[model samples]
Target: MRLPKTAHTSRPWLIHEIAGDFQVEDVWALATPGGPGDLPRLVSQFVSGDFPRGAPLIVRVLWATRWRLGALFGWDRPGAGLGSRVTSLRQRLPESVPPGPGPANLPFTPLYLLADEWAAELANGTVHTVMHVGWVPDGAGGHRGQMAVLVRPNGWFGAAYMAAIKPFRYAFVYPALLKRIERQWHAGTGGAPPLHT
Candidate 1:
């Protein structure tokens, strides 16, 4: 379910230090329940999960439409992306966060990774955004994932783009995405995920 911005702002997340200028666009709870040791696997599956092959029809259509529009508008041109249009958030990662290229095959670049948290970033013609995930205690002696999206729009254009898609994101994209994540957590991994430092 969609969570209030405070759900993300109140955490001691390193993203607050790295992207203080960005707005908290959305926060959602991932339903992947497991133990403390499950964080690494959680992050891995999340970044690697395939959302296009068999996602709900609306999701696939949205993905296709988005890519087509980006292609048509030069929204994802190389000049508009990381290290070009804007600086990478990696510049702000403190010593407490590991400085490494995040996992391969994902759309976003990993800013940093800790045992319980991971933050990645992406930039296009429209916006520079951060996707931060944390492993939080479930209050029932287990743990689940929480995701927060932080964004800094390019200008009025960015703001308008965000406003236009807000409803579709909340109504369609997130729920289906989270459901896939929850399903993968329960069925994909054979056992405990390998640890990450």
Candidate 2:
């Protein structure tokens, strides 16, 4: 579910050190409740891009439309993406931080990995954005996963693009994505639903 910005800001996530210039565009409490060991499974699922395949019809259509528009406008061309439009976040990371598992299906590049957190980044003409997944205490003696999206717009075009997609993201994309995650989580956990706050 959608969460207040504080849900991300209040946490002392290492991402803050490298993404200070980015804004917290969205924070979500994922429905995948489990112990710490489950973090890898969640991260693996994210990297696999299975969630998008399960998105609602409207969300899928909108995504295809966006991709088509991006191609037509050269918004996501190679020259407009990572290392061209913007340098990879890895360049900004301190040597102490270790790299996370590389993406398998998603377009993002792995940024950093920690015991409870993993981050990846993507860049295009419109924006440089971060996708962060974190394991947080569920306040009932176990832990669950949360996801946050941080963005740094390229310019007026970037800002406008983000604004235009906000409604579709919240109203259609996220809800469907969450339900898919929940369904898969249950499927793996013997069909028991996770506790939701």
Candidate 3:
């Protein structure tokens, strides 16, 4: 479910230390309920990029449209992405933190991984954004996932792009993706065995 901005801001997340310049774009309480150990599963599933495959048709269409638009406008070209348009957040990460397992399904680059949290990033002409997923106590003696998106807009085009997509993301993309995650959770496919240290 969509959550208030405070739902993300109230927590003292590690992301805050590194991404102080970014703005919180959205926060949602995921529907994947399970034990704390399930966090790895959630992260794994997200990295797999399966949600978009099962998302509603409208979402798929929108995604395709966005990609096409990006290509046509040179919005997602190499020069507009990470290490070019903006330096990666990995440069600011503490040495103690290990890089994430990497993304399989999305265009994002893994930033860092922790016991209960994972982060990945994406950059283009429009913005450099981070997707952070964390496990949180659900107040019922169990745990669920929470997802937040943070972004640093590139400039006027970036801000305009974000504004243009906000309604579609909230109305179609996120809701469809969340529902898919809930289904995966109930089906016991939302997670994987914990990664060995």
Candidate 4:
């Protein structure tokens, strides 16, 4: 479910320190319900997603369109990503840790993996993005996952690109995503064992 911005802002997440200048694009209540110790399970299932696969058709099309445009415009060139177009957010960490790669199909770099929270980042020519996941009480003694997306647009072009895609994200991408998470949670498997344990 979509949540108020305060749902994410109210938490004292380390990301508040690292990405203070970034915009809070969206906050969501994931459908994965679990115990307090299940954050790793949630994160594993999330990052393991074969995105645009289980996603809605429109979302798949959008992903295809985006990659095509990116290729055509050199927006996704190796030099146009992290460490070149934008410095790595790792530099903003309070204490540095060795960077870990995300899933094979995705481009995110895992920033940190704490007991109850995890953060990962991805960058392209258009924007730098942070995806934060938190294990929070579900108000009934159970726990669930929460997500917040923070983005820093590069310039006029970046801002325009974000604005153009806002509707599609809200309309298709996010809903399909949360539902997919829900399915994974109820399926009694997290694809792999916990990571940060």
Candidate 5:
């Protein structure tokens, strides 16, 4: 779906799904070019507020490590592994690991199970959706895009649950996180711009 900006707003963004002919139930058999159908399920962990708000950094680190490791072991398809990584990371975190950074000495029992399930299911194939949310200023301006991948597991409610979180993620979380990253990027390059906010 393409959402165009009106006179009131400067940024215009588009949300589109790139997929081939395939049943939602059989999405796992779909190929990479079809995009991931499961992403919404994984992203729901963040959008539903099931997780505390202060741990994006830790979540990000864990996600990266998990994907790298999964790929190294050949348990996941290189293309589909990213989404599985996010899902697996969320499953690994104990309800006890506070959102903000701290000692994360939690055991890896749950994570191992998650990894095992993903590996078993993926033995056939994995499906993934790479959602790209872009922000473009009013016409004749520079534009940028922030991309995210979603991996969905089976079930109707699970798929619906994942789809529901997409809009909120675009409206809030991703934008804020991108802004934070840009600020740090500027600060490291030379110094932060004088604060006006």
Candidate 6:
């Protein structure tokens, strides 16, 4: 993911400019592993009402993923349908649960797509990977938008682990993840010229 120089001075964000027809509808998915127990936990800690309050500003790769994809950018709102789930979880958590550290200062405008329960179970069972794929304009003024894919290990721990191990992850793990994402984009684009991030 490529970002402006200013991105470094601000909160971390990841952005990938993709190729596709801007007019067509697009989808973004954010998939994670673990059972239903993890869903509520992940939502409560990482994807919840307190997110925006803790991590306020964000710059996203201009797209229409509004509610679903906005959380990665730290633009999620408690009223954005996540309220129901959070409310259910709050019933479980005590009134004084500590807040997580919020979003990081990494600089990629995130793109994501959610998977179905069966697909998530399959991916979690063997690979334990969470991926992001977005359908966006091809930037060539075409009707077909490009689908971008980014694969990372399943669980919120990937984010925490990456942070704790940034010096190593950036030099080693991040490059590997980027290569995989680029490869998927190439494959999805079907021999079309690759979009430079």
Q: Per-residue lDDT for 1-197 in model 5, tens only?
A: 12332221222311111112222221111111112233222222212222212436654454355446546755355433434443334333456533221112211111111200111112102232322222223233432222223244334643563455446445544444445434433343211110000
Cα RMSD, each candidate: 4.4, 4.5, 4.3, 4.0, 17.2, 18.9
- Scanning candidate 6 in windows of ten residues, the lowest lDDT window is 117-126
On a 0 to 100 scale, what is the lDDT of residue 41 in model 6? 28
Pitting candidate 1 against candidate 4, the one with the higher lDDT is 4
Give Cα distance to truth, residue 106, candidate 1, Å: 4.1
lDDT by residue (tens digit), candidate 4, 1-197: 89999999998878888889999888889888789999878877866667668667887788888888888998888897789888878898866554443654677778888877888887888888888888999999999999888889879988998888888887887777777778778995543111110
Q: Write the per-residue lDDT of candidate 1 for residues 62-122, one digit (tens) a residue.
A: 7778888989999889998899999998887665668533544445787887777888788
Model 6, which residues run further than 4 Å from truth? Answer: 4-131, 142-162, 184-197
Clashes of each: 0, 0, 2, 0, 9, 21
Q: What is the C-alpha lDDT of each candidate?
A: 0.76, 0.78, 0.79, 0.78, 0.29, 0.26
TM value for model 1: 0.90
Model 5 stretches with alpha carbons more than 4 Å out: 1-127, 133-138, 146-155, 163-172, 188-197
lDDT (Cα) of model 1: 0.76
- The clash number for model 1 is 0
Model number with the top TM-score:
3
Which lDDT tens digits does candidate 6 get at residues 90-173? 233334443222213221221222221110100111111222222222344422222222333224643453344445434443
Ranking by lDDT: 3, 2, 4, 1, 5, 6
TM-score of each: 0.90, 0.91, 0.93, 0.91, 0.27, 0.24
Q: Which of 1 and 5 is ahead in TM-score? A: 1
The 10 consecutive residues of candidate 5 with the worst lDDT sum are: 26-35
lDDT of 4: 0.78
